[model samples]
Structures are given as structure tokens and as C-alpha cells.
Target: MVRKANEDSLRAQAPVFLVADGMGGHARGDAASQTVVRVFEEHIESGAPSTPERILDAIHSSNDAVRDLSTAGDVGTAVSGTTLAGIAFVDAGADSGCQWMVFNVGDSRVYSWEGDRLHQVTVDHSAVQEMVDAGLLDPQHAESHPERNVITRAIGADEYVDADVWLLPAAKHQAFLICSDGLTKELDDDQIARLLASHTGEDGPSTADVLVEAALGNGGHDNVSVVVVRAMIS
Candidate 1:
């Protein structure tokens, strides 16, 4: 529900949500993340519906805002950028109909828990992931690799950036999680799974609260941000 000042800015509205994790030296990092959140909020306030094209446009607008800041010397940094991940809900036109559209850039992640399985919905845009994809490194070795934190893409780093988007059907009792690499770097997938499972029942801690606690408890070496969405039939 809330992101640390050290973390990126986060925005959520019911079923539609987004998280952006920033990286840069000086205050540029904070500027980039805040700019993204502001752009997203503006679009939502103007009543923009959850659509792929609309979301993409919003991201582009955010990138431009950051670039403008850099050009205006407001950020005072040569390079500043952020990773983004978000989900939008869609109506399936039936009594129990709903679906989700997921999008991401850089290393921010989205996870879906359905049945008894946990699935990673976003692909990381880091050097380690690239190496794994190229068969130069095993997937299991990516975590501890020296270049694990080296990201290949970010919102304002380049003139343009590509985002990965996917359409998925909604599932009963399913949960969606979006988080920055800070949490993942410290906690393994298994540990996250266990936490999600344990918090599934009654009045438990919100996902954001639980994840923050986990990261702080683990080390809190970096900023941590988490957004969780639970699906329910209307």
C-alpha cells in the first residue's frame, strides 16, 4: 500500500495497480520514480481505463517527464531511470468473468499464485537474466552472480524502452504480487511462497506490510516495495 522513501513510488486503484523501482546516484533516482507515479496518477485521475495502449502511453509520458527534468538540470544527474510493473483488470462480460493484463519493464516483477503453485509473471531485464537466456549462465546461479544487479533496461535510461505485456485469465482465490528487486534479492521464491501461503486466511497482515517486514528482517540493504491484489467475484 505504501513504498519506502528509499524505494520507488507506487500507485494502486482497486484492481489496477503499478510499482516503479528507481536506480541512480544522487537525487535523480527519487525524481525518476516520483515522476512515473505522478504520470500514472494523472492518467487515472482523467478516467483512463485499464488498457494496454493507455498504460503504455502513460509509461511513455513518465519517461518523457524524467527526461525533461534531466534536460532542465533539475535532477543534476546524467543518468536516471526506473523499472515498472503493473496489472489492469478487465471484465469478461459474464457473471463471473474477469481477466488481468500484466506489464513490466526492467527487473521489477509480478507473481501470480493459483492453485498450489506460484508463477513468476515478469521476466527480469538484468544482465544475469540475459546470460541465463543465452545459456552462458544457469538460472539457479543468477541470484549470487556478481552482475545480478546490472539491469539492461530502464524507463528513462534510453530514448525508448520495450515493455512485456501479457493477458491472463483470472482465477478463483488467486493472488497477484508486484515487487521490486530489493525483496527478491534478499528472499528466495520459496520464502515468498511460504509467506503468501501463511497469510492466505483471515485477518492477516496486508501483503505490502508482510513483504516489507520480511525484507527489513532479512537485511533491508536496499529499498523495498510491494503491491498485492486478491481477486474476488463481484
Candidate 2:
């Protein structure tokens, strides 16, 4: 409830489900994240599965667009950056069949949810995450660490983007959760799982809506963005 502006943006329609949490405070974050959505919308056509190359191209193009939003000050350049996480269905090849491409940059996340279980598919590109990986800090304490918000990488923070990606076979049943750090900071994995596992009927509020509400209720210290995608391949 403390934010002056919502710096989070998302594109949750079919074919592309992504959440981008913009950096650079209220002044520039909203534009940075929205730029990502707009660029992707332009690059990837609607109502069809895209190729891996197309998705990758869109990401790189998004980085360039976000970078263009930056401004140079007398002291230094004020860089615009955002955390991006998304899932898309891609045509692998004649032999490889189709697959789900999950990609992430910075601390936003993509999770695979199946059988009422939650699994993190993308690793964070943040200072605390590196500390946790190097055994310098406990995973449990990483979130509350003073440097938890210091991201090591972002879409436009550097000239070259290093996105973490994973490919999963398109199966008969699949569910995914894409969210910004706002939700995770207020709600842990257990809370998120319980909410996602709860059977919200067609008439009820969506799981994504419920999760965002839960975060707002908890503290709402930041902008929250959530996208829940369920695919049935037959």
C-alpha cells in the first residue's frame, strides 16, 4: 500500500504469458516494463505457437527498447531495468515436437505446478541469490537480507542480457505460475501453493487474482503482478 505508482506490467493472453517488474522507481519503471510487453506483442503474432528464434529475438529486442528509455544525467546515466519472466509454447522441430520455453531475467520467476506441488523453474539473478548459491548465506534468510533487492542482472541494465531458460516437453496437462517479487516477498511458497491448489471454480476469482490479493493483504510493500496459465495438450 506504499507504492505511488504501479511499476509492474504483464501480457497474459494466449501464446505469451509474461510479467515484468520495472526498475528505476515510479519515474521510469512503468515504461520499462510496458515497453517489454509492447515489443513482444509486436514481434510474436497472435493465436499460434512461435519459434524459439522468434521468442529469443523478441527478448533481445525488448532489451534494446528498454535501454532506449534510459536518460543520461550529469553524473551518470540513469539506467532503466526490469525483471522479466515468461512462458511460451514453441515448435521445436519435426523430430523434437513442441515444448514450453520458460525464460527469466533478474529476480522475477516462473514456476511449474503439478499435482498440487510447486517447483521453481527459473533461478534468480540477484546478489542474494549468488550468495545463497555460494553457500555464504542460507536460502531462508536470503529474502530478508539487506541486499535482497540488489539484482545482479536485468534486461537493460547491461548491454548484453543473460536470461536463464528451460525447455519442457508439452505434455497432456501443465500449469505454470509467473509472478514478480512483490508476491513472493509477502507470501511464501507454501502459501502460494495452498492458494493455487485451492479449487477456484469458473465463477470464482482466478488463482492469479487470489494470489495478488493475498499479497496485498499481507503487506503490499511493492507492485504485484501474477499470471497463471493452464494448458491441456491432447
Candidate 3:
């Protein structure tokens, strides 16, 4: 846990919530994450119609900021980087219910909590994840893998970054979670699911606090952040 300064950034709006986890041990990580969040906030606050393309554009702008900041003098040495993950509302055309536009970069994640179960919605862009996908690593063992923290894609790592995006129909009685790898490192999917289910119907902020507490109890090896949002028909 970073006391004096934190590298995690959160942005919340109805149907639009994001979590950016700055890479640890990197220079200007906090600034990198802040830049990412600021770009999204500006887009949202601009009063422009929200669309999937606009969200993607905002992420590109964020990437530009992170890339620029990472190469600035003292901050360039370590190369600042951060994981971006979140959901945005997407209109599904006339007479169709809205859908969720989910995107992710690096190891931070987005999860769907439905039917009393937790389903990871975003694929992690990390070395360990690649190993798991290739059948070279066991999911259980991957947790402690030396390359677990080696993210393959990050917001500020290069000139361009592509995020994995998914669109899912909006559904009631479902909850969405956006969190940093810190939370996942301390709690497995089952544990997180159980904890979230136990707090069903509770407010998002309360559940978020519980999650942070759980991570801390399990040895918070890194900065932890969580955002819990329940889907509802407005």
C-alpha cells in the first residue's frame, strides 16, 4: 500500500466506471494513472454523446498522455505504465436495450457477478496469462509464477496500446466489478465471488471497502482498488 501517494485511479458515472492501476516500481506511475483517468473524465464531462467509438478514442488520448509522460526526463528512466479496465454504456440502436462496452489493458480486470457466481470478463495481458492460455502453466500455480506481474500490454508502455473490448447485453440482477491486480493477487475468483455474494444488495462503496479490507487481511502486497456496480433498469 502506498501511503504518501497512490498510483490507483477510479472514475465513476452511471453505467461508466473505470479502474486504472499504475505499474509498481515504475517512475511517475501515479501520474500515468491520473492521466489515464483524466482523459476519460474529460470525455465524459464534455457533454458529448457517449458512444463506443468515443470511449475508445478517449483511451487513445489517455495512451498518448501516458506515453508522453513516461518519456519525460526523470520519469523516462523507469517508463511509467498502468493497467486500464472498465465498462461503458453502449446504445444498441433503436428499441434495443443498452449494452456494456468493456475494455481492458494490462492485468487489471473486469468481472461479471451473476447467478451468485463470478466470471472474469477481461483477459489479462500478462506473461502468466499467456502461459496459462498456451497450456504451459496451471491457473493455480500461475499465481505465484515469477512472471505473474509481467504485463504484456499497458497504457504507457509504447506509442500505441490496444485494449481488449467486449460488448455484452445489459441485464438486471447482475453486478459488475472493476479492480486492480492487487485484489486478485490476494483473493481468488471463488473467494471474491463469495465475498461479493455475501454483500448482495449492499451499496457499492460499502462492498468496495470490504474488498479492500479482505485484500489487506490476505497480505496486501500491492496497492488495492475495487469498484462494485449493480446493473439496474433506469
Candidate 4:
């Protein structure tokens, strides 16, 4: 475990779990990620209801903050950007259980695990991902593609950022994972599913540790962060 500051930021408060992977190449990267997390922390701590609009507002504010930081003379970076992926709770419907509001910008991801399968909830805004979606590149080949790291969308990278959003039923025994590219870069979907299945009934922190360790074991070339949220049966 290195003692250096991490550019990746995570928020794991119940009903709101997220990961931000910074992309400015040094301290600027740290600033980008920290700015986003700080805003989320404040939003969560404010005791505000987790409404879809409120969450989107917080994300917009984070984008402004990151862009502000990039332009600030002190940060020394002309442009700082980051990938954000997260899940928050919102009303499903009257008398219905709450739903997971999943969103993403750039390559970070949100995964839903249920009954021995893992499904990706948010699409990656990266070049490789686009190729895969367009059927020009095979999923297996995309992993080793040279342009795999190039993301088409990110907060602070542009004036207006559009995040892909989804509202899903938060069923009992279901687990959701929000993570940066670090973990996925090291391990594929199959590996992630197996590892997650291994810790189905364990605590969040424990599952996180195992996932991080697995990434580091396979050459942790980038900063990695993960947040696991589970819906339990009472």
C-alpha cells in the first residue's frame, strides 16, 4: 500500500455511493476528483432528500467546481476533467420500493448484480466503448485496444456534460457497484462478477478491499476506487 495521495475519490454513504476518477495528470487530477467528492459530501450532509433533480443539481455543481478549479491560476492546470459513476436512491412509485438512480460520465461504471449475474447499468463514454457499441470492435478486442483509455465525455472537459442515467428497481438481495476504470482495466467483466459473487453476503468494505487488491495484483496502472451498495431483506 503506497502512502501517496489518491486522485480517485469515493462517497459511500448509504443510498448514495459514487466514484470519481480524475484526469489531469498530477495534483490537478487530485483537485478534480476532490472537488466532485466535496460537493457530494456537502449535498449528502445537508440532509436533503435524494431526489433525482437534486442529485443532478449536485452533479452540475460539481462540474462547475471542477471547471473553476481548472481555470484557477493556483492549480496550474489549464483543464482538469474526471469520470463520475454513481447510484442514488429515488422514489420508484407510490407504494413501490425505492429505485436505484444510476448515472455516469466517461469510463467509470455502475454494475447491478443479482442472481449469479452482473449487468452494466451505465454505458462508458469512451472510444473503445463506442466502437463496441457500434459493432466495429469485439468486446474482447476492445480490452486491448490502443485507444481504450480515450474517453469521449467527462465533467470539466466541456462546457456542457451529459450523463447517461437509469432508474432501476432496487430489489432485495441485489448489489450495486460503482467503480473507476482502474478495476475494470485490470480485470474483465467475468472476473469482476466472480469476485463479487465470492463476497455476496459480506460487508461493503471487505468486498471493496478484495476488488482493489485484485486490481493491484494485475498491475494497477491507474488510480482505482469502488463503492458497493447492497439492498438487504429485512
Candidate 5:
């Protein structure tokens, strides 16, 4: 709650729900995140499903756009990077039909909400996450790890960005939460699950609103961004 500005940017348009967290230290993070949103907005159409190829192209375009923010003298010394996590409704092949293309570039995350339980869909690209994957650190200690904020990959950190992706069936009922690390830094999975269980889409505030307020209440020192995507196929 004490940050000078909210560098996080998001796109909640249909077919795409994303959260981009700008790298804060010594970086043009706000512009980096905004670049990502703008690139996606320009590349993908609204209120309609997209193809996997188009989404991938948008990811690559986002990296190029964010990288453009750092030019000339700033190339080697300056940093313009951001973490991206989101889900896109895409048309898979004839066999797979329509599905959710869940993708991630850095430490931001996408979680599937089912039966009031949260299941992380995208793996983080952070140092602590690497350690946890290597069995060098316990999952329970990852949040408190000193290198939790140190990400290994970002949109503009490298010339080419390879997003980790997954495919989920276009089920009858599906819900997903795309968020920046700011929310995770403040609240744990149990707290988020409890909040979602009590959330009624038609009543009171939205799920994203409640979650953001809860994170801010927990001494949110970083920018918090959350996007809730729901699909009900009757």
C-alpha cells in the first residue's frame, strides 16, 4: 500500500485475461507492463476466441515491444522487464477443439479454481521456484526465500521469450485467477481459497475486488493485480 505507483497492468477482455507485473527496481516497469497490454490489445481481437498461433505471436510481440522501451545507452545498463501470466480461449486442432491456453513468462501465475480449491496452472520463472523445483528448497519456504523476487525470465529481459503453456478442456464450468506476485506475497493459498468459496458473483463486490482488498489489507508493499475469468457452458 506504500508504493509510489501501481506498475502492474492487466487486460480483462474476453478471450484474454492477464496480469503483468512490472519489475520494480531500477526498471521502467510501468511502461514495460503497459507495453505488454498494448501489444496484446493490438494483436488479438476482442470478444472472440483466438488461435494458439496468434496468442504466441502476441507474446513474442510483447517481448519485442517491451524490449523497445530500453534502447541505445539503456540497453546494457537499463532494465525494462515484466512478468506475464494469463489464459486465453483458443481453438486447438480439430481433435482438441476449443480450450484454455494458459501461459506464463515470469513469476506471475494462473490458478484454476475448481471445487473451491486452487490449482496452480503455470510454473513460476523465479530463482526460488527453480530451487524448489530442484528440491533444494521446500515449497513452504519459497515465499520467505530471499530470492523470491529474483525472476529468471521476463518479457523484455531477453531477445526471445519462451512462454510456458498448458491446455485445459473447455469444460462446462471453469474459473481461473490470473495474478501478479504482489497478491501471493501478501496472502497464501488457503486465504485465497476461503475467499473464493464465499464469493458470489451476483452479490456484493467481484472476486477480484475482494482479493485485491484482502491483499492490500495484508500490508501490500507491491502493486497488486488480479483477473478472474469464468466460463459456464450450458
Candidate 6:
């Protein structure tokens, strides 16, 4: 099972298997995250697969909801936005696979782990990430960058947002990890790779719980949320 704050606002569609992370000032963050989750939940509850297109639409809807909430002045001095990542089971040709779709507005991340390798599947929409992309800064320097926490795109920050989406074929027993920056900011890919390799077995959770626990053990300074899923053949 994925873990987050007791008061955390989160949504998950088990059939679709997705997670969203929200960021905003004060309680507004909670509200934004909750709103996105609620939107997805409504669709899934209605027996929708919550396709990639539907996921994108839900994100836009959540963005509108946040904007509306901000305009209504209910949150009061709080700007709201969130990051979203999800997977939908799919069957293409003779192969049964899963489609991985991610929509992130901030620094939260999605990763895929297979064997001893860990791969980051989502790019952060943050200042530090921009710098790294432009070659203005090395990834090694990102951890201590003073502007590491400054994000360039987010929900409710503006009227328009662009999300990166990808379709990946899931392999049997491969693990998918979705988490907030609170966790990845402190843990490196190699560390994550090691944990995934070490804890995977018959008795394991078959997800990324060990990774989340490692981050918390190092001191969970910010809100930490994680969802781990492993693909299996029936």
C-alpha cells in the first residue's frame, strides 16, 4: 500500500493505478491535490479506464477547480497546484501490457525499476531542472542549488499548463514508483536502485515501500507521498 500523510489529500484509481502530488501554500496544497484525486476518482468510480486522454482532461478540470477556488477566495492567500502520475492496463496485439502516463506540474517524479537499474520517467518542471537541461548546471549541483525548490510550472499559477506524457510497456515484475520531491530530493538514483533490488522477493511488498521508508528514515522534512506498483502476468 502507498503511504502519505494522515491528512493528505490524495486520489487513486486502482484499476488505472495512478497517484497525484499537490503543492501550494498552507492548506491550499491539500485542497488542490484532493481536487485532482476526486476528479480521477469520479471517473474511475463510473467504471472508466481513465485513459491517458481522460487523465489529461481530469488534470485540466482540476486546474480549473483550483483556479475557481482561488477566485472564490475560499483558500485565502494560498496558491494551489499538483503533480499527477498514473498507469492504465492495456492490451496491444497479443501482448498484455500497461500504459504509463505521467502529468507533473512540479518536482514530483515517476520512476521505473527493473533488475539493478532505476530510470526516472518524469521530468521536473522546476528551475533547477531547466538549468540542468540547458547545461547551465550539472545534475550533481542540483541538490544544493539555492533555487532547487523553485518550480516554473504548476496548477493555479497560470491559466495554461503543459504536461509531459509517455507510453511504456510494462514488464512482468517490474516496479513503478511515483513520489514527491520530498523523497527524491534526498535520495539518489543509485540508492533507489539498490533498495529496489534488495527488497524485491516473494515476501516483499512488490512495490517501492522500501524506497519511501529510506527517505523518511533520513528525516522527512517535507510531505512525502509514494505509490509503488509491480506488473504481473495472470
Best by lDDT: 5
Candidate 4 TM-score versus the reference: 0.88
Error of 3 at 129 (Å): 0.6
Over the full model, what C-alpha lDDT does candidate 4 score relative to the true structure? 0.81
Which stretches in model 1 have alpha-carbon errors above 4 Å? 1-5, 45-49, 72-77, 91-98
lDDT of 5 by residue, 1-234 (tens): 889988899999988889999888847899999999999999999988898999999999999999888877675337799999999999998998999999999999999999668998899999998999999999999988888889999999888998998988899999999999999999999999998889856688999999999999999988899998888866
CA deviation > 4 Å runs, candidate 5: 75-77
Q: Look at candidate 5 and tell me the lDDT of residue 161.
A: 96
Better of 2 and 3 by TM-score: 2
Better of 3 and 6 by lDDT: 3
Clashes of 3: 0
Model 4 steric clash total: 0
RMSD of each: 3.8, 1.5, 2.5, 3.0, 1.2, 4.0
Query: Per-residue CA lDDT of candidate 1, range 1-234, in tens?
Result: 233567477887854688888873534678788888888877654323355556678878887776665654544346778888888775535553556889888898999976467799999998999999999999889988998878887888767777788888766566788898888987888888888877854577786788779987888777888888887754
Full-model lDDT, candidate 1: 0.78
**Whole-model lDDT values for every prediction:** 0.78, 0.89, 0.85, 0.81, 0.91, 0.66
- What lDDT tens digits, residue by residue, belong to model 3 across residues 157-219? 877888899988877656899999889999999899888978754555588888889998988
Clash pairs of candidate 1?
A: none
Ranking by lDDT: 5, 2, 3, 4, 1, 6
Q: What value does the lDDT take at residue 93 in candidate 1?
A: 51
**Candidate 3's error at 99, in angstroms?**
0.7
Candidate 2: residue 131 Cα off by (Å): 0.3
Candidate 2 local lDDT, 129-207, one digit each (tens): 9999999999999989999888888888877888888889999999999999999999999999999888453568888
| CA displacement after TM-score superposition, residue 185 of candidate 6 (Å) | 1.6
TM-score of each: 0.87, 0.96, 0.91, 0.88, 0.97, 0.82
lDDT: the better of candidates 1 and 6: 1
For this target, which candidate reaches the highest TM-score against the unseen true structure? Answer: 5
Cα lDDT of model 4 by residue, 19-59, tens digit: 99987353477878888888988776443227777788888
How would you encode candidate 6's per-residue C-alpha lDDT over 126-228 as one tens digit per residue?
A: 8989999999999999989999878877666667767777777655565677777767865788887777777864595643566667887877666666777
